[model samples]
Target: MIKIGTIELDGRAVLAPMAGVTDRAYREICAGFGASYVVSEMVSSKALQFNDKKTGFLMDLGEAERPAGIQLFGDDPAVMAQAAKKAMAYRPDAIDINMGCPVPKVAGNGSGSALMKTPSLCGEIVAAVKEAVPVPVTVKIRKGWDKTSVNAVEIAKICEAAGADAIAVHGRTRDQMYEPPADWEIIRQVKEAVTIPVMGNGDVYTVQDAVRLLNETGCDLVMIGRGALGNPWIFQQINAYLTDSCRILPSPGLYERMSVMVKHIQRLCAYKDERHGMREARKHVGWYLKGMRGAAEFRRRAGTLETMDDLALLVRDIVAANSVAEEAGR
Candidate 1:
């Protein structure tokens, strides 16, 4: 177990907050599969301050999922503090400041990773949020604004000094975006430099990668982002691999996969209207079929689906066809 302030997480594997992903349905799924913690998608402090309906909807954590963190992004200290306070109403286990998003619109406004360039301002934001909330306050950061400024260690120290309970370091410079390799060495350095629990993220695609990150970086936790796109089983795989060095089990057969996908769609429908749910399910369906045989055709069908019934029928067909093909191969 790893302790972040007074809260104890069951394991070291966490789900990284992704903008349109990591909603309540996904968080509950990951928690069921053994993820230690899950962070909500980044919400704008400005939007929260304005009482945006969409932003308020994003903060909603269904009764099934608890102990999740709500992450906020903004450049203004007062606004950030107020946002953190507002997020507290949702009863998140913690509040996280997003200092690592490399998106142009976000960083261009001096929020997200732009905070890395102003260490003192970042420190002030952390202090303000920490003072405003009763729960643990954490900060997520990148290596630096770019390769030339690589100052995560320095910024991490400032956050710790400002009373952050923990720090999560994504080991890629803002310029790298989601590129080649994530510099685990820099993650290692940050872990070594900080007193609070450090969670290492980037390029962790498999259970072996998770093990390697822990062994190499000595970080208290590993946060999985792109790797968990269609693979919620990753949490179970990592957990099993850590406890027992067996080659982790493969994904379930086509029928089982379809069952999970169907459940995801139903959950989405329950959370939003049928039209919005079907629309959102398109991206998830694409991710679910990724790399599988006939996935291109399946993706095309899934994208054009107009109703829940259409989606369910399409998934059933995909499963049956795939199972028949597998039998023929055998």
Candidate 2:
């Protein structure tokens, strides 16, 4: 078990927050699949401060997503604190501050990874938010602002001093974005420098990667972001792999994958309306069918889906096509 402040996770694998992807439906899916922890997408602190209804909607957590985290992003300390205070009404198990997003719009505004350039400001924000909320307060940060400014250790030290319960280190600089291989050495350094739990993220695509990260950095937990796309079963597989003497689990077959796609769409539709759900499911289905025998054509057709029936028909056609291909190979 991994403990972040008073929050005790049953496992070490966590679902990292992804905007537009880690919504209530998706968080519930990941949690049900054995993800010990899950976090909401990054919400705008300034927007929340202004009482933006949409921003408020972003913190909505499903009943099953409890022990889940809500992540907030912005540069202003006062705004972040106020947002944290407002977020408590939703009863998140913890509050995470986003300091690692590499998107230009977020970083350009001196938010996200921009906070890395100013350790003092980062500390002030953490301290303010910590005082405003009763739940555990954590921060997610990159390796640094850039190669020339590798200051995660310094910044993490400052956040710890400011009362952050935990720190998640994504092993990349803002300049690298998701390009270059993550420097796990930097994560190791941050872990060594801080007394609080360190969650390691970036480039963890498989259970082995998660295990290796824990062994390599001695981090308290592993956060999977891109790796969980279309693969919520990863959390279960990782848990089994870690505990069962490294037993290799077979990958899900076509039928199982398709069934999950349908379930995911249903959940989306239940959470949102049918129109918006189908629109969003298009991308998720594409992710689910990625690299399949006829995925390109299927995805092209999926983009035109306008209703649940359209999605069902698409899944049927894809399954039939896969069956024909399998028979031909046999």
Candidate 3:
């Protein structure tokens, strides 16, 4: 068991926080699928300092999603420290600092991956948050600001020295956002450099990928991002493979897939209310329909979803079409 301070992470696979995607509802859904740990969507330090009410929802961790972390992004040490203190009110098991996000809104503001450029400030922010919060402090950092820099080890060591409990290394530099072939070697380097636990992240899309990453880098955990987007079952598959003699679980059946998708969207609606949740469900529904027979057309209808009834209708249509496709194949 890996302990982020006092919190014991029971599994090696974790859900990486996505800005607009990893909400409270989604975190609970992923946790139900055996993700050892999950993180909140990125919260702004400045927003916390100014007492933004909307952020309250972002930091909400349900009992089902135990041992979750609330991720905060900002470069200012003092502000981040205050944000950590505030996030503690939501009772996160740990406070994770977001130093890995490559989005321009964050990086352009001298936050997120931009913090990787200033190793000293990164250290200061970790030390400050560690001081302000009662829980453990962790950082997520990229390989570097650009291809020319490549300084993850330097920053990892600094954060460790400054009281960071753990570090997650995304293999690409900020310059290569979401590019193929994430440099897992950098993750290996940071794991070797730091005594604290290192999580290897980037390009892990399947059970084999997760196992290979763990076997290859020897990191403490595998943090999965986009790969887990519409595929929470990846966690279950990874768990089975790791614990069950490398068994590969087949993908969910069509009925089970539709059932889970509807349940996920229903929870999203329950959490965010029907109007906002339905809008958010568009992309998620699209993701769920991936690889289905006649999926392109279904996804087009998913985009136009306006209410629970609309979603129910779309799901019924998907199930009917796929059922016939399966029957014919047999």
Candidate 4:
């Protein structure tokens, strides 16, 4: 079990907070699949403080996604603190500070990974948020701004000193930005430098990678980001392997994948209007159908879907195509 302040997680794998992904529908799905914890996509502190309409929509969490954290991004300490207070009405299990977003729009504003360049500001923000929220306050950071300035250890120390309950270290410098070969050494160093729970992230796409991260860095948890895309089962598979000494199971069958895709879209439809939901489901459907037979053609067709009936037709066509391929192979 991993403890983030008073929040105790039953597993060791967490869902990383991706900006466009990790919404309420996705978080509830991951939680049902046995993720140790789930964090919401980054909500802008300034936006929340200003009572932005869409920002409030992002903060809504379902009951199933309990023990979740709402990640907030901004450089101003007062704005961040006020945002934390505003977020309390939603009753998140924790509030996570997003210090690792590499997007230029956020970083250019001295928030996100830009704060890594100023460790003092990082501490001040964490201290302020921690003071404002009654729940645990954690920080997610990158290795540093660039190769020449690797300060995760220093930043980790400062955050810990400033009363952060836990830290998540994404092992790539902001310069790397989702490139191949994350430097796990930085995560190890951060874990060593801080007494609070540390979560190791970046390049954890497979079960072996997740296990290697935990064993190598001694981090309290491993946060799955891109790996979990269209593969919520990764949480269940990793948990079984880590907690029970079970063999890593093969990927789900095509029929099961289709079922999940249908259910995922259905949930999105319920959360929003059917028209908008199907549009939002385009990328997720693409992710789910990736690497399967005739996926390219199916993906091309799936993009044109505009309503529930269109999506239903697409699923039927996919299944019929899969059946034909199976028989031909046999």
Each model's lDDT comes to 0.90, 0.91, 0.92, 0.91
Which one wins on lDDT?
Answer: 3
| Per-residue lDDT over 1-330 for candidate 1, one digit per residue giving the tens place of the 0 to 100 score | 898887898878999999998888888877878888889999999999889999998999865665689999999999999999999889889999999999999999999999999999999999999999999999999999998999999999999999999999999999999996999999999999988999999999898899999999999999999898878888888888776666687876666677787888788878987898888889988988887778999999988977888997897788777888899999
Number of clashes recorded per candidate:
0, 0, 0, 0
What's the residue-level lDDT of 223 in candidate 4? 94
Which lDDT tens digits does candidate 4 get at residues 1-330?
Answer: 678999999999999999888888888888888888999999999899788889998899888988899999999999999999999988899999999999999999999999999999999999999999999999999999999999999999999999999999999999999985888999999998889999999898888999999999999999999999999989988998987766788889988999888888888889877888888888888888988889999899888878888888888998899999999999
Ranking by TM-score: 3, 4, 2, 1
Runs off by more than 4 Å, candidate 4: none
Determine which window of 10 residues in candidate 1 has minimal summed lDDT.
243-252
Candidate 2 collision pairs: none
Error of 2 at 186 (Å): 0.6
- Candidate 1, residue 90: CA error in Å? 0.7
CA error at residue 269 for candidate 1, angstroms: 1.2
TM-score of each: 0.97, 0.98, 0.99, 0.98
* Structure candidate 4, residue pairs in collision: none
Q: For model 3, what is the C-alpha lDDT against the true structure?
A: 0.92
- What's the residue-level lDDT of 276 in candidate 3? 97
Q: What is the lDDT of candidate 1?
A: 0.90
